[model samples]
Target: MKKIKIEPMELNAVKRVYLLGIGGIGMSAIARYYLHYGVPVAGYDRVSSDITQTLEAAGANIHYTDSVGAIPTAFLNREETLVIYTPAIPANHSELEYFRSNGFVLMKRAQVLGLLSSNYKTLAVAGTHGKTTTSTLLAHLLATSMGCDAFLGGISRNYSSNLILADQGKQLLVVEADEYDRSFLTLHPYLAIVTSVDADHLDIYGTYDAVLNAFQEFVSQIKPGGYLVVKQNIAFKPTVGKGVGVITYGFTPDCHYYPTNISIHDGLYRFTLVTPQGSINNLTLGVPGHYNLENAIAASAAALTLGVPTEKLAHGLESFRGVQRRFDVRYRGTKIIYIDDYAHHPSEIEALVRSVREVFPNRKITGIFQPHLYSRTRDFAGEFAAALDKLDKPIITEIYPARELPIEGVTSETIVKLMSNSNAQVVPKAELINWLKCNNVDILLTIGAGDIDRMISEIVNTLEAKENKAINE
Candidate 1:
């Protein structure tokens, strides 16, 4: 919230861009955006991962250390360099301190996003669980039917990147509106979708009601005469400004936009998407998941509002591959199936398990879940236990602490102790693949929001080797 020497509207005045936490998903997308516009980009992160590697490949100067010397020399000139940072960066971070002392132009990632929305017709999707999938789907739908530039929170398997650049004509911007730390408040979208609002980030908001109130404020920020597309069954009912249009979508026909004649072939869905404009028959979602049917409806409504033809929407949906790590099926072996998902909250876990059960009926599901934060683990241990208990075999891993210090006695066992399912047990992330080697798994899921993703490739390889050895014997 510090006063910026150069506002995002004055981005052209800035000579270079530097990010504090360049490896983060949202931050990396912005870094890519600046790079695409021919700006010199540099940054610092605590660690390097696939995201940072990709950014480096795309002409970003990134370093893992926090030293001020780690910054590129070109970005050293405070007057010419704009520094963007994420909320995850700590107050004591040395590079952040150096930027503060040097009097550089500063902005939060969301602030720049708000500035972008001011220039284009913005379509934003906000929620606790389904925002990534919904927003990515909307971006794909718009990009294929018409054209759009998108800042996504997840890597799109179709685009293979989180940032999508719009072609010259009919530019629209699609963004995933994050609710954590009230970040989504910065956006005033022409079309906003709320997929779900659940009790999350208790570390920040402290109460479920606070989470609802923040979302309520978010919807109220939608531009007048714009559209509010929300789920019919979510707990919160939004209050929008005068002349703002409201549309509801869900599984049943009572909603404004719903699907009918749902059928599945080879794990993919074919259904009639019923919207107020008209129905798109035989629309096939490129991904498999019962939960995604609702996402499709929300995205489809937004796409239709923006003048996308029904035929183009249908074609786009059929070709749309989902975001990576959101019900991403890595491999399908004859005896073993491996999937990965970013389901950190209890509600997300429940939906994921339900969809997995429906998709691979009669297959035993063995899920490895790494809880994300200490506060969340402390606040929702029982709920998590109940949700994870739904898996035939639930393997709980060590908690991944992103920002907060650990609370005494709050560990992965915090959830396992509350579980009624005897099969549930705690394991360290380092030992997960070894555990997999010994255990029998029919359907395997690696689920979480943390570095648990780093273990995914090894897990898939282990499962594949196990299957091959079985056949050789």
Candidate 2:
């Protein structure tokens, strides 16, 4: 890979920007940032999604096809237009090829983020999982108090957007440092938080040790005099340069920052945040789940390190509504409760199941999981099965292959057959709602990081209709 240096002042010279996959969450956030800065933006996506429509509504020119002819004439100027593309896009994409051949400066989305980080005091949140929620909450906390700009991985419920703009004088920026493709290495953070360093994206790293080594490299990228806050019990050790501070946060007392005297009341988690500086007592997180409590602690620690006062931090934590699909509760009724999450990894699945069980111990939990990628399912089939088996009933659906082709002999049955639960079975996505109608589902969890979310509204409507019929009867 060629190393190109982009200075902060050079960004002002670019008259327009184009994105190859503009509808993606991270890409859209970057697009929104440029749009806010008065830069003309146009892009192409494989399909028109809600995010694409929102960007279009906000003055971005977007197209659904990959053809070079669809490119806006104004963006064809190679010198004035900067092209940003997601790593997920295929190399053969016509729009990307056109830009490359035409001498337009093409950059990965991570590189753009790195350039932006240089202009502001960046607080980067990175990990295999938990980074999305932790970063979103940390952004909310800092934005609520001191005010900051943010590019989040997920749409924050509190802000109702992934891109949080700062006031005119605000110089702080919060970013979700994605570990995939080793993208987080590009960032030089003033404050960095690693929530977990679990082995994931093996297709990219090819080994668990490589993942750890990448994280170690990420930790090394923290700027001098910056702070590094990590979750307790994560395997990777920090190799920060001099003047960098390291702190750990989790549920246990050994962590520098932890929660004490935890309790759940009315579906909310209340705890005391015990940090090295001081303790914030009776802090109540607006979101549910045990894993979320840990996330809140990590976010709080990062915020506190940045000089957010204890009172503002506590209020921000309580006011946070959480990110969409992290632990989104679609419906809660006496007959049935339905929740949806974007948990594709086995460790994330295990956390979801354990949190759900902790919240509703007596409820008969039924889980419908669609594996996200062929590579992930093929790699962690047994782990996925074991995680889903924690539920009372497990329903595995066909894999949602985001980029990779289907692996031979690896299907939903691969997980179903390995599940220890006798009630486990493989079901097609089309039949899921119908199956839900016939089954006795006390607590329903729809889990995955793919098109499984497309089925949520239908499932909710069916469940509501069923509940109405029972009420009338």
Candidate 3:
């Protein structure tokens, strides 16, 4: 395939922009960006979601149907309109086909991001996991002190938006470098952070070694004199170019940047950040979970590297409110507590379960998990089962096939059967909410990366109603 490079200045000529999957987290950020630039924006999504509605309210035209006729006529101009589509959108999508057939300039979402990043000093966060939280926190840190533009994967609660525009005269850019579809390779970052190199997206890489190779390639793309901050004990050794620097950070003391003297007070984590420059003592995180502490360490390291003052870093970490759906606490009461998270991978589930157990040790934790992808479920069923077995009671729902067709013999039962927890059972998606209503849930956790999030409002409402009824009784 031939690559077509479009400079950032060329975007100024575009009067309108159309997106195929505009409601996606990444694609929506780009939509918001175009809208911010005063361009007329419109897009098609498979469903009308809160995100899509938000976009509509912000003046971008959106439609739920996928027909070509549904596209607004204003976006049909071939020379004046640019079409951006997510990779998840099917190749045969009617609107996508119309744009391609009509000679409109079409680009992938990653390509558009690459063009935008090239116009500034891009700081990219890439990994199999933790990239969203790390990148969002890093954006918060930089935005608070020096002002930066950010393209985040998850919506930051602090800012209430995923796209953060830079203040005038600030050339800094922070982006979440997605590993899926080898999208991160499009970015040539001035600074990069590799949080972890876990084997994932096997459908894309085919083997674990290929995944490592891709990360190594990503490291090599850093511009000369750039810095690469990586997590301690990552398997891939980066081949950094001359004048490029490497730094490691983790919870251990050996890391150049780490934390020590950890303690929790008033349900929050307080620890001293130990860095090569100096140690910041008695710092507290605004979010919960020990894994989040590690994410904070990585974000702080990146900020410090960029010459953000220690005081600003401390304030940013303490004031950060965390991202939505990462570890969102929906409800808390004496009778029942409900939490929701976007953790579909086995390792992520393990960390979430462990953190919940640490926070509420005496309570019975009931986990309701919906597996995300067929490939991922088939690839990591045993690992998923093992992690879910840690919960006091586990409810497994059918797989949510995001981009892939259903695989024979690969279902939620695959993991349910492998789990050692005798309380584990396979529940259909239709019956999951009703099943929860009938049960006595002490600590409720809804964990997955798919449509499971759509059910959170109902779960919270039901649980809240239950708590209110009990109180009145």
Off by over 4 Å in 1: 1-9
**If scored against the real structure, what TM-score would every candidate get?**
0.97, 0.96, 0.97
User: Model 3 residue 219 lDDT?
Assistant: 87
Compute the lDDT for candidate 2.
0.89
Q: Cα deviation in Å at residue 37, candidate 1?
A: 0.9
At residue 92, what lDDT does model 3 achieve?
A: 89
Over the stretch 196-291, how does candidate 1's per-residue lDDT look in tens digits?
Answer: 988999889989999999999999998888999999978887999999999999988788899999999888899988877667788899998888
Residue lDDT tens for model 3, 394-428: 99998999999999999999998898999999889
**Model 3 off-target regions past 4 Å?**
1-9
TM-score ranking, best first:
3, 1, 2
Model 1 is weakest, by summed lDDT over 10 consecutive residues, at 1-10
Q: Lowest lDDT 10-mer window, candidate 2?
A: 1-10
